[model samples]
Target chain A: MSPVLEVRGLTAGYGSLTVLRDVGLTVGEGEIVVVLGANGAGKTTTLRALSGLIPAQGSVVLSGTELLGRKADARARLGLGHAPEGRGTFTDLTVDENLRMGGLRLPRNELPAALDQAYGLFPQLTPLRDRAAGRLSGGEQQMLTVARALMARPRLLLLDEPSMGLAPQITANLFAELRRVNAESGTAMLLVEQNAAAALTIAHHGHVLESGHIVLSGTGSQLAGNPSVRRAYLGV
Target chain B: MALFLQRLIDGIGNGMLYGAVALALVLIYRATGMVNFAQGEMAMFCTFITWKLADHEFGLGLPIVAGIAGGVIFGFLFGAALERVVIRPFESADHLRQMIVTLGLFLAINALAAWIFTADTQRLASPFPSGALRLGGVSVSYHQLGVIAVLLVMALALRELFGRTRLGLAIRGASMNPESSRLLGVDVSRMLMIGWGLSAAIGALAGALVAPAVFVSPGMMQTLLLYGFAAAVLGGFDSAPGALVGGVMVGVVQAMVSGYVPAVGTQLQLATAFALILMVLLVRPQGLFGRVSVERV
Candidate 1:
């Protein structure tokens, strides 16, 4: 099957400082691709470039459409959703408003159903719907970012470090929810993560990003068992 | 007692107008993190447009309501156009430059209005029926009550816009976090432009409403702008409800100080508003209704 997202020779960075260099990857329909990297390994930059939050070079095509030259909002409308690094939740807004903004392009009639699905997956959000998102726990905020990205009902969702500052148990729970979302909705995901063990648990395929280059690629089970991955990331 | 009550009502009526302009200040600040120093001048220009529509110059001699409506529509377009032409160019520049640009706008608009309106103080007719309603001991002018009513409706409409509608959500979202709003398919630039347009329209309404009492002229808003700034700072820079409450308090304080304090009566009434602003800045920088943003690393 054709990949939902295809990137070739992707390079992006802040002005005068290149972070990603000639990186290439793909995620098939309903697949979860986890990118494992250490701090400053260009993981967040990759996601930012894909989301058009910053400038980038090379090719990023989503479901056969070239996304280069499109602005961030236009890319979002074209069905590419990114739950950015640091959660990026509208902290002052109520949980309900945050979720509504997530599916901003959805038809008015479809909003209720989309909201219901989000609330159902993260039942913890139901009670806090009226509360501001900033008041939520870190884990809940992570869930909110993920659920918000789902609001767009994108063909491919890009997540930057969903496990940042989250407890192990919470991280496990988040990955489980992500798996369920993929299974049910057939949505593809490109997950950027530092937590190797938890990320690989739900990922079907994995790539290791080392200094803006993809150093290794394999199935999730293979990478989880790899000696290099275990030494550098898994800490096994 | 009747005299005291009358002053109090008058203060509130004027306060609401100040609050209207202050609301525009707050909206622009929240959206762009920059204050439009030219806001008062923009309102002054729109008020002139309002006056022209009502005057026989155009020979239409439309009524006050239609004139105000024309002012509002013109204000909206003019505001949007200004953002695109003047502010959008320096969008990425430093905040100091942005302030300078607005200052330039202030002088240009003020001068333009003087040249066009010819420095004349025109009598802008009041849409409200003249006379007063006597209730028990206190009497209130219909014009004063009308100003209060208009401000109340504006506050409610603004509340509804921010709280209920999708467009409002987009604006609020853009103001709070432009980057996130963009990620969510909201055109942040477009939202900012709309914010300017809406704010200018509100300012026009305030100017038109107060013109009859103050007289419509190029420099009429100069003194009122100080009061409006004081009201905005007193209420907090980011809160709408705070703007209204702050405006009323500033108005009441001025009235009370001028009336009760012998020295401040007429000559130093403006001083009272200025003093209140200084005290608020020194003591509680966040203002009454503004949140003290705590950043968690």
Candidate 2:
């Protein structure tokens, strides 16, 4: 498949601190692309930059749509869903209301079907739908965060950290569902993760980052089996 | 016994008005995290507009009812303009600076009102019809009943607007998380402006309604705003329901204290709110309805 998104020489940071520089990548349509890095390595910045949270100098084109200068909401209106690092769930809002904010760009009539689909992916979210998102368990909140993003019916799903603090079993389940999301919806994803072994396990393409620039780029399995990666990152 | 009942009723009436203004303060805090010290003054400013519109000569000569309708629209527009022109630039300023800024805005508006309206304490006839309904032992005047009715209606409309409607939901969501809400297609700046505008309009209702009973003047709302601020804190800064309940309770307390406790005269009314603040802060800093939010690693 041709690339659904193309990023070249992406450079972003907050105020004065530069977190990402000279970073480049491409995401094929319906592909699961992962960015694996240690803490504070500009992984979250990449996602934020793409979704218009941080101003950046680079080309962030989703099917040729320029996303760099747009406001966060305007970018969202163009179908980019970002589940920020630590899930940023509205603490006071109910799970139902939290999800409602995701698809704020869609017509009102489409909300029910989108909600039903979201609830299907994470059945546990259904019972706590009425409860405030803040009261949810860590794992449950993570799921809610992801589900909330899906409400936008995004063409590109940018996940900051999907496996953070999740149980191994739940993490596995989440990865499986993510794969399914890409497969079923034809949605492209740029997932950032600190869990190198786990992220490389699911992504079709993988890029390893250290101090901002992409140091290694290859197929997921190739990166996973690399001896250098195993010795340094995979903790083999 | 009749005198006691009468004081109690009057206290409750005043409390609701205080609550109305307090609710405005709370609304501003929730959306922008700043208190509009001039909340009462803004109400006074808008009420003057109502007074002008009701004028027979240079004015539109509209009926009192028409004057009120005009006041509501003008209040909204003026509020939105103040927010956009004044409050918007101060968004990045620290809380203390913001507080001082709003205080300045309040003083400026008050000065303008005094200059235009001539600082005279103008008598404003009751917008609502004047009458009292007797139910067995107690009598309820239309003025008090009218205030209560208006407060209730305003509360319900606010609840529905913020909780259920799209515009309201967007505003609610936007304030709670500006970054995420913006990405979700909400214009955070515009949303904040709308909130200030709505809060201003609500304040106009209270000021205009009370103009007749209290008399309209630039400094008329100084004391009332304090009561409202105290009520908002007592209720929880972010909880609208708390502001309402706390307002009514505070009003009733003031009335009862004036009646039962001879020491708590007009001078001591302000003291009552300060006392409430001390007691509430000692007990529940989150106020009545606010929940403490815990952050996780």
Interface RMSDs of the predictions, in order, are 1.7, 1.9
Cα error, residue B182 of model 2, in Å, equals 2.0
TM-score of chain B of 2: 0.95
**Tens digits of lDDT, candidate 2, A138-163:** 88889988988888888888998989
Best candidate, lDDT = 1
TM-scores for chain B, listed for all candidates: 0.96, 0.95
Question: Please, what are the lDDT tens digits per residue for candidate 1 over residues B1-297?
Answer: 887987798788878888888998987887677899999999999999998889776425999899999999999998889988999898778779999999999999999998987687888888899999999788888998898888888888887887788988888888778888888889988887988898899889989998998998889898888898999999998888889888998988888889889988799989998899999999999999987654334
lDDT of 2 at B277: 82
Over 4 Å off, model 2: B135-138, B294-297
